[model samples]
Target: MRTLVVYESMFGNTAAVAAAIARALGSTDAVRLELADDRPAIGDAELVIVGSPTHGFALPSRLSRRAARAQGADASATARAGVREWLGGLAAVRADSAPFAATFDVRQAPGAVGAPSHRVRRRLDGLGFRTIGEPASFRVGPTAGPLLDGELDRAAAWAEGLRGLAR
Candidate 1:
């Protein structure tokens, strides 16, 4: 099935996760990887997967920050707006009948902290995605992640599982 893995990355950890997901989909021809700004066409694809690295509790980094700051938005507002804009771009093509999923990648912290996955999942659900599964996270290092053992394999496996949800 056709699939698109769209993602936002800060220190490249998230990009690695996106790549792993795309690889597990096993569709060299049908899968595509895109920076969130490229606004990939998901119309023909049977699945659309959106991912981002967590920043400031529930925000996405880099482009989302710039997009928000340019408009003088706060962290929370920026995140909400960014996700909305990203999904809005797909609205013209994404079939209301088709299914979609969302996930996030976060750095491994030493103690308990907030996770942005639930917020992302809620946003995707609001956009009418089927909410196929719980959001997933890949551990990252303080700088340039040593990726906490097994995260990449876990991401690939998660992607493989997600494939079953495709319609």
Candidate 2:
């Protein structure tokens, strides 16, 4: 199946998780990994997985992106548009059989103040994608994180589970 994995990152933790997910789902061939701010094309995606660093208890706004970049955009790239803006600009497409979708978020902690996945899931649903399961989250130990140990493995495992659902 063709999977589209889109992500927005500040310190690159979220991008790392997105990459792990795509790798688990066969990144080299089937998965198309992209940065969300680039407004990645959702074309021909059997499964669409999106993720970002939860900011201010919701999706990142332009202000938040700017703030994050100030802290450190990391090597991958800072999100200029953010997932919120990208989703907002995206045209809703209703397929004959709604395609599967999932969302994940990176946060300060599991029960931290932010959770962007739910809102992202809702937006994707609005765009006519069938949700695969509950949104997922990966935790970071600090604000600028080298993601907590094992998070990458966890992300890969989560993607493997999603792959089963896609089948």
Candidate 3:
């Protein structure tokens, strides 16, 4: 099955998670990992997996926020446009009834940090992708991450499960 893994990373933690997922998918010939800016075409792939590191308030990174802002004149417009764009992207893909999976890599912080995965999963569902499971988070250190032990393995297993769903 052709699979595409698209992700955004603030540091390298999210990138590491993306790479591990791609590796677990096994063989580069079958799975491709691309940065979100690369704008990869997933039209031929059987599965498309998207990931992002949870940032402020469990939202996407500042870059994404900036893009959202540029697309709109105000915070409300930014929110609407961001949601629309995200949904539209999913819709374009889902028009073909293709399956998709998503995960969020977030720092484990105390108290009520926003869970970006909730928003991501909702958007994916809105696009008509059958959600096979919940999103996963990987811990980050003060600088970035070597990742908390076992996080990479957990991410791999998640990717493996996603692969199974695609098949």
lDDT by residue (tens digit), candidate 3, 1-167: 67777776655667788898899886643888877655566667667777766556555644666653554424532232222244345444455565666656556563335666667777777666666566766676653455778888988888877766654
lDDT of the structure predicted as candidate 1: 0.65
Superposed model 1: Cα runs more than 4 Å off:
27-29, 61-85, 88-96, 110-113
Clashes in each model (backbone N, CA, C under 3 Å)? Answer: 0, 0, 0
**Candidate 1 structure quality by residue, lDDT tens digits, 1-167:** 77778776555677788888888886543787877766666656667777776656655655556653564434332332334357556553244565566566555664325566667677667767666766787787654466887999999888888776654
Models 1 onward score TM values of 0.75, 0.92, 0.74
How many angstroms is residue 106 displaced in model 1 relative to the true structure, after the best TM-score fit? Answer: 2.8
Candidate 3 overall Cα lDDT vs. reference?
Answer: 0.64
RMSD of 1: 5.9
Q: List the residue pairs that clash in candidate 3.
A: none
Residue range 1-167, candidate 2, lDDT tens digits? 88999888888889899989988999434999998778888889889999989888998888887788777766357766778888888887777856789999999867734588988898888888888877988989878898889999999989888877875
Alpha carbon lDDT at 32, candidate 2:
93
Q: Could you tell me which 10 consecutive residues in candidate 2 have the lowest summed lDDT?
A: 73-82
- List clashing residue pairs in candidate 1: none
